[model samples]
Target chain A: MYNILEFTRNRSTSVEQTDDKTLRSYCHLNDTIMEAYVEIAVTIPDLEIISVQGDVLRPHKKEFKESFEFLKRVIGTRIGPGILKIVNGLTEGIRHKQFAFMLEECCHAVILLFTKEDLLSSPRPDDEEESIIYHRQMVLDNIRLYNRCAAFAPGSRIVEGIIPKDKDI
Target chain B: MLKFMRNKIVGIEVKDSNTVLAHGFLDDNIYSIEMNVLIDINHLEIRDIDGRWNRWTTTECKRAIPFLKEAIGLRMEGDFSQTVRKVIGRRACRHFANLLLECCYTAKQASEVLKDKFKEKHDVNNVTSENNSDKNVTPIISADMPDHSDTPFHDKPVSFSMVIDLHMHSFPASPCSSVSVDQLIKEAKRIGLDAICLTDHNYVWDRDTVEDLRQKHGFLILRGNEITTDQGDMLVFGMEKDIKGIISLAELRKEVLESRGIIIAAHPFRGFLTVGIQQIGLTLERAIKRPMFKYVDAIETLNGSVTENENRFTEKVAERLGLPKTGGSDAHEVSRVGVYATGFIDKIKDEKDLVDAIKEGRCLPTVFRKHAGLR
Candidate 1:
């Protein structure tokens, strides 16, 4: 059999506390080769963007090259709800949806990393059943974590039968 | 390691000359659901539907089974996806909706086959002639659902005199916000908000513009600023200074105190509840020890941007520290303006009244919209 198409994409994110009050997060996307990379520095607690930079090393299209210029627009903006819309509005007119996604992912990684201390300080569950119940309740408590990680994806044990409270009828 | 997998299988059978039965089975590591939908061959409308959950994760999963009845009269026609979403997806399990959509798709294909068979056997010119005449058939799902038209946007607590969304941003002031000032006011009124405060990041609304807006819309529009301090964000009311960029929390506190303004810790515990805290030793005692808590006058316990758990945590810390709780949509868009709000026991006529209310602990966090669902 002849294969008509072959594709594989991988994304990795990392955060480093550059200073006592600053966190720098980086996201890299690779589709067979290096496709896109974004780095953002935000202040702790406030999570406001102090600096941002990105490059489309292996462009999916030539229009994506213009995406780097719009990165400055995100500076001074906080990494929270509506950030994606803000990024998309700032990067409009360029085929830069992927770049916007990468920037958002970088912001999300910074937020997750900032909360790592709290996660590490939580008490451990006694058994597997208890652990499942604990995690399920955790997702229930914070529905924003839904589909954020593999463990919370739809149909996963942790999120199964969990109807989002805000689902518009 | 391979951790989880899910399988969905669907089958369609001709139950009779006028009926087609479509069966859908979904099995995974954590859930097992089987559903059967009986579809009319001529009209393509659902005649009957049934489902069962052999294995489920939560007790609430069973509550979704009864919602399946809403799909019985739905037609597998134009905009069927939206109808199914409104009917089966919203009030109950989305997995059930997904399975039902799949079964409907298969039933649609089976209906096509039956139509073809009818066309061949009866020498019919148009098997869909009857179905086409009922093109405007409205599904009963929407009418059967609870009416929210008369319901207030937020669930207000008794004894509260005025409701106000204390945290909101607008375009040109807060670059992240998509809504303009005019749009925000209109949306706030449309959603039944008694009043709204524009608390843009580092930018305070002009007093004249606010006054004009209040007069023009006949709605109370208050002014506040979301200051970015080194510690965190603070919603400062009754401050008219147009401060920009990040400042020290101490400096912000001193200024607010000097101006006789009230400061609220805005989503103070955001990102703290993203992980499972059961495995972490971060308790309320440890959380309350945060330095910023000493500076703010109140805590935003029902912020739209943060998770319910985060809001609850903030609420707990507020209770522990003897601080008043407030709510705000922190809305960048018009639609989110009143999702969460502050219910003031005393009437707030202007920014001073708002400040006085917060200073006197006359306001409590009230949720207008249950979920902001923003990311």
Candidate 2:
């Protein structure tokens, strides 16, 4: 027997400090052969997007000329609350929704980069039990991290007793 | 690589003429749950809810079992799923919330089916008296029942005489902000804010525009800058210089000192708690040693954008440091204008008065949105 359908998607995000005051975040998404990428430069502390650049390498449709230009609308947006709304509002008219997702991913990567050190600073747990307890408390303190990763997936040990806030009805 | 799968099953049965039983089972690689809810079909209200965690990962998972009772009186109506999530999911586990929501949905569907069956039976029996069929039939479910989800949880309005949102941004100045000055002012007035301060990132509202907005709207408008420094963000008041780009905390402190302005740490612990302080070993003692605390005059303990834990951590640091705490919405949009504000004990007539109030510690944090329940 042969499989009827097979599909795979690969997405990557990287953040690098380009200058003393700015950090550049780059995101790429590739579904089969079609690909898209977004690069955003944001100022530190404020995390305001000062510049944006991206392209849809293999357009799903012929109207690829202006598909990536819509990302410019998020140039001044800060990586904070309501960012998803801002990005969605900007790309509402765009044909390729993946571009918007990629842009949002870049912004989130920037945020993760700033806090990477804090995460790294955590003491390494000695055993599986200690690791589970540490991760559980981590998600408890930051509910937003719930179900965001494999370790925090529902039914996982880390999120066993945690109740979801249910931001969306 | 490892493959994992989760299976969830929900079933609804008509237990009696007026009661419906909805049960759900969830089984996965690491956890298993079984739950049953008895609902009154007449009112679509949950009468009883019982659940058991068959296979669980942690002991805390059992804590959610008690919260399941909170759904007993909840009517499966408008915003029913949301209410269930808030009451059960938020307190113990989201999985339980999901299961209860699934049960509620299934029960509602089953009730509708029962109602339809009853209506059909009534129609068959009243074939001779077609008009009388509606006379004796009572509606099992009310149509378009109003839900109190929109009602404010708290009725007490903010009693403060002078409430000012000290941190706000406007478009064109703070490029990141979507709300323009006009929209910000309109929203501030609409929400009954006594005054609003525009603290755009590294940009200050010009005096001319501030005066024009004040005169046009008949509302007090002040200007400040949310200066980005090497250490962290600072809300600087009484400074008129348009210090572009990021500046060092020491430079900002020097400038504020020269100008005799007051600086409030803006969400100082914004991302700290999210990183899991215990794992990182960032204790209160280590947090207080941050360089930004040494320079700021006050702390923003209540910020709209920060999580409650982050705000509490900031409050703790402020208490330990004996620094006065303030509040701000950090609003980039109009609707978020007065979510949090600073209440002045003394009337603040101008920027100077506002600066003096902060310097004198005559202000405290106030929550304007009653639903936040932070007051």
Task: Highest DockQ: give the candidate number.
Answer: 1
lDDT of 2 by residue, B1-375 (tens): 112233455666665555667777766444578898887766778789999988654444565676677676777665565466556765556667766765676566556655875456457655332211112221121111001122322244545569899998899887667778899999888878899999988787779978988999999999898887655678999988777655557788999999989889998876655662233344678667666788999999888776677777788888898898898888877767787788888888999999999888888887664444422
The local distance difference test score of each candidate is 0.69, 0.68
A26-129: candidate 1 lDDT, tens digit per residue: 87766533367888887655567888888777845666557776776667666654454455545555565557667766765654443444444433333446
DockQ for each numbered candidate: 0.07, 0.05
iRMS per model, in Å, is: 12.5, 14.0
Ten contiguous residues minimizing lDDT sum, candidate 2 chain B: B139-148
Say what the RMSD of model 1 is.
Answer: 13.3
What is residue A42's positional error in candidate 2, in angstroms?
23
**In model 2, which runs have C-alpha deviations exceeding 4 angstroms?**
A1-169, B1-159, B371-375
True contacts kept of 2: 0.03
How well is each residue in A36-94 modelled by candidate 2, as lDDT tens digits? 77888886555668898987777555576476687786665566544555576556678
